[model samples]
Target chain A: MAYSNKARDFFSNELKNINTAGTFKEERYIESPQGANINVEFPVGAKPKEVLNFCANNYLGLSSHPEVIEAAHQGLNERGYGMSSVRFICGTQDIHKELETKLTKFLGTEDTILFPSCMDANAGVFDVVLDKEDAMISDRLVHASIVDGMRLCKAQLYNYKHSNMDHLEEKLKETQNLRLRMIITDGVFSMDGDIAKLDEICDLAEKYDAMVMVDDSHATGFMGKNGRGTHEHCGVIGRIDIITTTLGKALGGASGGCVSGRKEIVDLCRQRARPYLFSNTMPPVIVAAANKVIDLISKTTDRRDKLEKNTKYFRDKMTAAGFDIREGVHPIVPIMLYNAKLAQDMARDLYEEGIYVIGFSFPVVPKGQARIRVQVSAAHEKEHLDKAIAAFTKIGAKYQILGKKKDEIIAQYGY
Target chain B: MSDDLKKLIIDYVKKEYLDDDSEEIDESTQLISSGIVDSFSMVALKTFLEKKFQISIPDEKATTEAFDSVNNMINLLKEFNVA
Candidate 1:
């Protein structure tokens, strides 16, 4: 009749074990709207401290943009609030349709279908397209959502090495026996901040007759010359088969995702994808605001341009400071601190110095690859970037890891 | 375990997942519990092993525990040999 102590004991022991292992996750609460700088209440109950944020996916700094907020309010006033039903059952508003159409044009895809989140889009996409006779070959370093999505389908699943085009080709060749071969990858590998060679991937897909899918969640808002995601950046527009991306990142930094690609695949998703069919439509305000975001970005690339400039500034300053960083033009800059405990400790120390960043270890990344992933936003001005860079330099020095080799850092920190 | 086969897996795991400074790996290394390879990534390794050895490791024998180390993976491969 009551919850059992036996089950409670198992969880309690597990928690204790995690604590002993120094991997217990502690969440830092943000007390203000997401932007370049925000108030974070760290260590749970401490007074909120304003810190220069460098860990948000607010790439284009539209999370709290005045125009986007005004758009949201205008939609709230005009379109009212929640959509109580699913899309097929009276939840389809004109604004929703408008956003999808605009997104199609913006993403260079023929059609688009909205989902509550990219996770839901991924979770529901695979099963609609693949069956037991087909096969799915994915990049091994793809997002966890893609991994979960692949599990839902009955297709033979294979993972090629991360970003190894030759290995992807090998998997493609191996899976050629199947009825259909689908290649899945992230447009930008989130952890590494590396861009996928979509140009090469598209060539492989063409040679092998495999369909290609890209989840451009990280690079959707501002990646190319025109800020049109990785397809445009890689010169492979109209070559990809299915693209699943998130509005939750740079596109207003709000919520909503979509499956945008050729008309037939999207048509299939609308008819069948479980998440879209069963779940209620996104709120009218989000839909309207997202439409405004698309219109703004379409009109000009100012915000994405600012973001690109900011990313270059931070990466250049940090690299010049002698920190071990993955060299890339992308905004996600990882400062490598090889030991797990060292990553956590450095993040805590950085928080003390008025910078908000998170340490990633183990499951979030791979083992022994602990890092402090700093995400630069268009919201960050010169002062904010300078402050964060200064804090990281101080913390890097305190840890004596500045310009140190990976072996030296591990020797001192001990993973 | 065959030294060459063990080296192949160690090399693959190191290059794919672990950093250059990852602690010394050997036949006794705990790949799963130590967080070097998660279950999903292990699936990639399974594909790699199957491709290299040209043997189909049954789903039941492909548990994370069975693929946790070079020794364990070697043991699992041994089952295919006997069969």
Candidate 2:
């Protein structure tokens, strides 16, 4: 009774507005495990349909791998199901320590500290390391989790243009008066799928006496030559002051994250990061599975190489199909459909055609930049890619959008 | 600032943000305050202004109030000596 109808009415009206905007998100039920192929049921009551998943974050296709399953099983056996307490409590296990050591080696960082998720890592990092006297300069397109973390901190926050190094340098130059300046960016922007210019960021950081942080969640498992991450890809591995990433994506598609960087910074994270201190520690099963994943990627580049090849092939064919695919070498290929309703309609149509991809609209992306973000995975073979490309072409033709530009598409479907 | 400069700014906003080419805004219309352009678009517009005018409008000077309208934008540019 204390929770009034006024509050209820507010949320109801807000949801109605969202529905009217054609941007209301609905979750599809998935019966199977996460992978390139999943059994999905849309709008809740419909029978589940077997669909080729083109929307998952399973970049390396290891989410449902037999070896990964076995490792997870082994882990569940060796170290029970869950950690009932936080890390500083009785939750820290031997496997957790082992995984940290392996991650440190794999990442080429001096130290590493684990969190329940990368969101937790981002949430806990800033307030622990920075205060009002410091300044945090973020790329305009950095992940939302980093933005939320910044909101919780008292530091002066500024944003440079997306991937614009000159703007970043200018911000850094002007912020030299602050006690510390931290330049933060995502390794690969999730929407645009463009790689960050980390080498230039590092040079600017050095010139301005600033620290650098990269939330390399999207690029952690298969970015560089050895898959160390964007730092390795950009040839600035040991120079990054803080490297935050996740195990929830390509690493094993389980849930865990870490803040890995300078030994002292990680030490401070362990001692002070609120999420690590307050939330329950990462489960031991994920630690054991992540250990196997790190070991596998460390020994072989087969999966990542396959992923890269598959991505390039898919991108080339999609471009040839005349879809307005965002130009990127990353697997997060956003097919730009400027209208929200068009994006949703295309996604629904593609789902009916047995391809599962989600449409992203405003506020997930900027207004008028709505699209269907197709995530290409290594599990998909040439047949899958060909079928997906054919499906897209057919759908594009149906919508009369195959050969259209942004303005043309917008004219057909309002932005 | 010259009337030509204000027209140029208004034209850029119409082309980029209001691409429908139907809705109109004069020199005194609210841009940022009325949600015609958000912070992200403001940065993009700031980038355009900087490149077009060859002036560095520092982040602090490019406030919401400064970018709220074509008139305010012109005033901020006037401080930068962009006529």
Candidate 3:
């Protein structure tokens, strides 16, 4: 296609700015399956090398599990490939209904409705239910999907401080003149592995007569005692009004998500949610594998237990090594580098040492809080953790990110 | 008082939006266009300015013209005679 000079110049300048800003995102190709150790080829033409992956969302490491693969294979043989239609049409299958039932039972919700992805699930929710008369009080640090969803809705929107119940209450009070109010937050914030104070949020919701919604994408498969979610972990299992989560993260790392909640909400989503009504149904193989993953996690707590132990081991060793690690039990551990260049350099050096991790800087996270986000999975063994920690310590010492108080580093960097 | 308000907002932005000494942000620098402060940060900043300055920013005055830069924020405050 030919472009006008004006459009071409505009896009070219934008690309140049992105490149000059040191924020241009580049994708690396993985030659092997998703796991703790995978073969990656960087620089496009380079040979693939085995690197210990610590950046995937595969918390339970079921992304390439043998049983999950086998189940997908069986599903393909039994149910065929794609649905090629939306759920309300001819796409509805027994397996699809079965998976929804399993998710509802697992989440302790009255009903569930699946979507192509959690992004779609989030995008479809707000506009359908809430109108101009309603108000949405959202955590400032909620996922981008939630922000986009709020934008699509006509409801009066207000963002409170991240996970601040007092700010939430203030917003609720400010919007009290509205007909209906809903509070939205992430169950576990992806950037920081901090779990939301759902119990407090639920209490505030009750006090203000508002409904609570949580996007538990980061805490679905192995968060609570039974891996129910943050609501279960925070002792507000039945208190939450709506829960949106993904099968793409922990539940076998396939591609599907669901909004599970009261029957009316699910029914409304099924009827009016644009994504569900427009997008094709999830492939049968993925649904089957996700169903199997839920069954596996429900039957045994082994994966979640291993993940917990690995997180503790890595967190303790890194902290003991004088590396400033964020205090959290979740696997998403941030080794603070404060300086964006330092973070990028450390991640590059770690990759050279055969450990794969990504550095997050401004826009993705708040500015001046740059860090290498290390995601530990149940798939990582003790040796893998040891190797990653050693690489981190070595990189840390080289970059002078260790052997000093976090405050000292921040002050030195003027961050 | 306007200078003090600008200083306060600059310090807050420096603490919250800056990570290193690479980028120079002045009073006239665009906060939203330059990606220093996003929608979320805008909300927080609005709350902070309202509480600290003891002035209510009406819904119509909450756009980029009023809050895009330290200078603009100070101008808005001065217009309200709060600074």
Q: Give me the candidate number with maximum DockQ.
A: 1
C-alpha-based local distance difference test score of model 2: 0.89
All-Cα superposition RMSD per candidate: 2.9, 5.6, 4.3
* TM-score (C-alpha) between model 1 and the true structure: 0.92
Can you tell me which runs of candidate 1 are displaced by over 4 Å?
Answer: B1-26, B34-36, B44-61, B74-83
Give candidate 3 regions above 4 Å deviation: A411-414, B1-37, B40-66, B73-83
Q: Which prediction has the highest TM-score against the true structure?
A: 1
Query: Using lDDT as the measure, which candidate wins?
Result: 1
Q: Evaluate residue B35 in candidate 3 and report its C-alpha lDDT on the 0 to 100 scale.
A: 64
Return the DockQ of model 2: 0.09
For model 2, the stretches where C-alpha displacement exceeds 4 angstroms are: B1-83
User: Which of candidates 2 and 3 is the stronger one according to TM-score?
Assistant: 3
User: What would the per-residue lDDT of candidate 3 be over residues B1-83, giving only the tens digit for each residue?
Assistant: 76777789998776555645465678999898656678655866886788887888997988866788999888888878886
**DockQ per candidate, 2 decimals:** 0.44, 0.09, 0.21
The worst-scoring run of ten residues by lDDT in candidate 3 chain A lies at A157-166
Error of 2 at A252 (Å): 1.3
